[model samples]
Target chain A: MFGDLTVDDNLRLGAWQLSGRGRSRRKQRDTSWVYELLPDLVRVRARKAGGLSGGQQQMVAVGRALMSRPEVLVIDELSLGLAPLIVADLAEHLTELNREQGTAVVLIEQNARLALDLCSRAYVLEAGRIAAEGDSAELAASPDIARAYLGEAQGLPSPPDAQDDPGPDDPGPDDPGPDDPGPDDPGPDDRGSADSGSHDRATADPAPTPGTAKTARGNQDTTVQSARAATREAK
Target chain B: MSDFLVYLITGLGTGCGIALIGSGLVLIHRVTRVVNFAQGTFAVVGALTAISLLDTGLPHGLAELLGVAVAAVVGLLFGVIAIGRRGTSPQAALVVTLGLGILAYAVEVMLWGDQGRSSEGLSGAVTVFGARIQTHYLLIIGVTMAVFAAMAALFGRTDAGKALSACSSNPYAARVVGISVTRMGLIAFAIGGALGGLAGVLLAPMNSVAFDSDVALIINGFAAAVVGSMHHIGRTLAGALFLGVAEAMVAGYGSATYQTVVALGLVLALMIGQAARTHSVVAEAG
Candidate 1:
């Protein structure tokens, strides 16, 4: 994200990939489409993203990636330094995105519980190598995974289930593959990167500062409730 | 009073030229992060092209237009050589610009000889208040304002301008969003060249420009650019105009020989002050 540029400008530049041959215009999706996905961003569209709060900056970052309308959305790390509630809200948006856009998302996170909650399948990366890979629930239950990520060995109460579960109306695991680009492909067809399954990734990376105020365990309750509320509003 | 007016007005005229050159420098450096040593050569190209066209009976406006166009093409070529290839660092490109400046001197000397040339553009003088100054000075000031306003509009109100600005503010983020950094760099250089060329043609009517006149011209531009943070147009213009006026006032009221010395000395002081200010700011932020 261009911190110096307005939220609108940052999102608009994403279209440069395959739209209008560098002419600064998208064929099907307009830049306003991003504001539609993240409605809270509209008021601050003219403000520079650099001066915005971490949560707003995260919104701008995700809105920028979605402007390209990619079939495969890859988020490196989603939970770094962000408030738990903010993370949940973003995850819920991602869930909604997956259901609506049918874009396959590969979200990599350092938080094991969040990753497992958001993803059906998971992989544990250790020292640049895959340590363990399996179903999210299975990995969560494994003693080794449980000890390392879930804090089960330490006897910490299990955190409530994250927004990874789809509601009655939303379809992600059941949706058609992203590989099957429907007749109305919103993005450039030549984007060779392809993927399977569905998840509209909206990784709102809280720009790692010195560190954020600790709001982890206390916010976890509201995090779940708001995540569900967001899913409902999205539906 | 008359003497003061002459010095002040003429200083502003030269100051306008420096601002144009500095604006070019800032624009290119802001986008590409390359310090082009050949910036002054652009003015030489424009002025010489205009002068050469006079022999062929082309009108003044057309000749000047062609001169600016030629300079823009040269700027594009400079961009291609400096940053066109992958892996060309800004340091490497800066060195290449120095070489290109030398190359321009060779071409200029071969065509126009090592001697100086001047043209009586917008011939005659205009009276201001109770004093008289060249009509050309008014033209220079007018044109400079128009150019700066256009530049401000381009960067502030246009999408292409914002994207170009984005290429510099956060280049890594810019690439992630799919902006062609190289293409934007080329555009900045071309615009820089046109501005340099405009300054040269404007200055041609006032003084004799030699093959090596760029050495002196660029000194003024670099000072203005450095003092202005090399990006902010309004500040660069203000700094350049002050330098021009100071140099002119010194020439008018004091010794002409000390003009370059005075200009350079002021730049050194301004540079040190800015550095100290920035250092203190960072310390406070920390």
Candidate 2:
């Protein structure tokens, strides 16, 4: 479905079962929420999903599912074939979605550290048998359980702070996360940093002041975005 | 040049009919991955239904619509039997459509008999570019264009249309996105059937439709669809028009018997070309 369809259309199909007033309402709410959740998707909304990179495709897939407004979203593998940073960013979005929308997410992951970090409850399956089940914090702390499944290969040190976001110095996925600036939180600092990283180079020759830099960066972003949209339309 | 113009105009009408059927074939194949051999049967049934209804003093327009509706119902039935099963492979579904075609043939024979049937199509000739052409041919052209336009809009502007295309692109992902693949398949078959029926109703007056006439219609339509690689609607229509014009020219310039040879040769050459292209692409990818 994603392969040949535009990101917008793919998102529309997610809410296929809805129609009439319900459809329009659901479509407006879910689509806006998805666009907000995955801002990168906004850039490539008109582009064919097949043309997108694998990570972009995955984001579209997640966003598409979210458009359905499912009460319990079952994701097959949240971290598959993605960089750990991307996985972290996505997990953060999922957490935010859960918190804001009260949408439950069931993530099936091989990466136990990430899963334990994001989820409250944990269930371990080995050879079609239930190996262990407990609170995620207890499962993560258990030496025997961690050794058996979450060993050196699957092990990545779980973020120590629960719900405490990475700091400004941390140039990890969180800093440039699309879902970073929630509606309530005005992360002006993060925005400045993100603009500096992506838009600074383009505007460096002109050496714009801090006051104009924001608007200049906004203009450049739109220009680049529209250029991409034009190319897509031409295609 | 006048003679050529006459032939081209006539060919355009014939091409429109063939293209309508080919479009149906292509639509079904695109969504369901099934080459519906029974598409021609939809035309035969529709024409027959319209003709039979005309005998009951029904208006021509209403009869034609009824014919299309009947064809859509038959399409849904075809979908249920052929594509509704969970494990049915495309190959299996294709064979089922063939069986349905045979079933339609039997039904046509029972109801309409083996004799040729005709309807009171618009009778009169119009002069265009110093050449006389049947007015009904123009109607056929108009109808085909209208149908194509509607389909294009449906696909391009509508959410349902996008969902159908999405189902074709990846059924698993489509399902995950909450699209019912079975529903899309059924809709595809029904739309394909309606298109086939409309083609039949339009072509009935121009050509005497017998029970077995579908064999020729399917053959020509299939030939055109194969030329487009069974995906592109515009390309399929163009292929149909090309086949129609080529057939008409061959019949006019040479003999009617030679037209079959030309069609067969064209199909063979195009299929081979397509095969070579696909093979090279696959080799390159590998």
Candidate 3:
């Protein structure tokens, strides 16, 4: 998003692909659906994105992505530098997007607990390799994952973990493989949601794990943000 | 008093012309971070092309339009050579533009020869508060005002304007949103050339253009643009006008030879002052 641009301007830029050619006139300039997804942006859309609060800026980011009406949303660090309350609000919006719009989310995060909570299936990594890949619940409960990552990642310094932020040229791995072949349909609203979390630039990444891994079930529009795991899912 | 008015008004005309060029520099610098030395060459191309078209019996307006279009194409070529590659640094692009500007001189001289060209624009004088000035100067002022007003409206009120601005605001984010930074930079260069061309065509009546005339034009224009840090249109306008009127005043009251010295002096003084200020601002904590 352009920091100098108003929230409105930033959101409109997301629709650049649709607005260029002979697209339908109705969808060309429309941003009403984006406003609906993030209702709080209505009043402040006229304000510059740089001036907004971190949470509001995050909303603008998510709203801008939603403007593309994309099937998948990839975020580098959703909760970075944001307050916990704001993260919860953003998490709920991500869930709403996944539930209401069926937008698949790829959340690259250092917080293992947050990632496991939102995803139906997860791949836990150690030393640039997937130590475990299966149902999110089983991985969360596993002692290896708990001791290696989930339990120890809380408020701790960054361990030897893979970085987020997808490189366009080399995005790492595309598939974590169909090893477990877990549920694509977890529950009524158990579709993937990225609970906004951040690897704060000011503070160190709090991952206690050795590294990161990425895994995706669906075939289209998978955006991997992990340095190691990015090679697979991005294709 | 009328003598002073003549200098002031004429100076303002000169100022408006320089402002047009300065605005072009501002736009290109804002988007691409390239200090386009070829900016004044754009004006030269526009003026020369207009002259050639006029010789072909094209109407004045049509000739000017074609001239500006040709200049815009030249600007696109500049962008292609300067920043077409992904890894070209801004400094490298700047040097490339300087070389391209010099290269353009050869092409221009080969095509037009070494003669100055001028067109009698809006012939006759308009009387103002006891001072009679050419009607062409007023046209220059009017056109410049209209251009600036249009620019303000485009950047401030329109979505396309905002998108153009966004290319410089946060390039990475702009890319993530699918705004092509490279394409936008090219558009900026084209617009810059067109603006420079417009300035040149308008200025042809005031100052006859020779093949090498852009050397002085760019010097003055770069001075005015530097006053605004080459990124702000409003400041560039103020700077251009200040230098333009000051030059006129110097020529009127003192020596015409000292006129260009003012431009050079301003740039030198401003750079030293900024460097000194930067040094003073720097502090080390143990």
Q: Which predicted model would earn the best DockQ? A: 1
Taking the tens digit of each residue's C-alpha lDDT, what string does model 3 give over B51-89? 889988999899998999999999988998999887577
Worst 10 residues of 1 chain B by lDDT: B170-179
Ten contiguous residues minimizing lDDT sum, candidate 3 chain A: A195-204
Ranking of candidates on lDDT, top first: 1, 2, 3
Q: Where in model 2 is the C-alpha error above 4 Å?
A: A19-30, A130-138, A145-235
RMSD of 3: 10.7
Native-contact recovery for every candidate? 0.39, 0.44, 0.39
Error of 1 at B141 (Å): 1.5
Interface DockQ per candidate: 0.21, 0.19, 0.20
Off by over 4 Å in 1: A21-29, A126-135, A141-144, A153-235
Model 3 alpha-carbon drift over 4 Å, by segment: A20-26, A152-235, B267-286
Report, for every candidate in turn, its global Cα lDDT versus the true structure.
Answer: 0.75, 0.73, 0.72
DockQ of prediction 3? 0.20
The residue-by-residue lDDT of candidate 2 on A1-235, one tens digit each, is 3566888887777666555476666544367778898887899999887676545666776776666555655555555445556666777777887778776666655545556767877676554455677777777677765554344322335454322211122233222222212222312221111111111011012222111001111233432332343233223
| Model 2: residue B237 alpha-carbon error in angstroms | 1.1
lDDT of 2 by residue, B100-205 (tens): 9999888899999999999988889999888888899899889899999999999998888998897677665555445667789999999999999999999999
Highest TM-score model number: 1
| Residue B86's lDDT in candidate 1 | 65
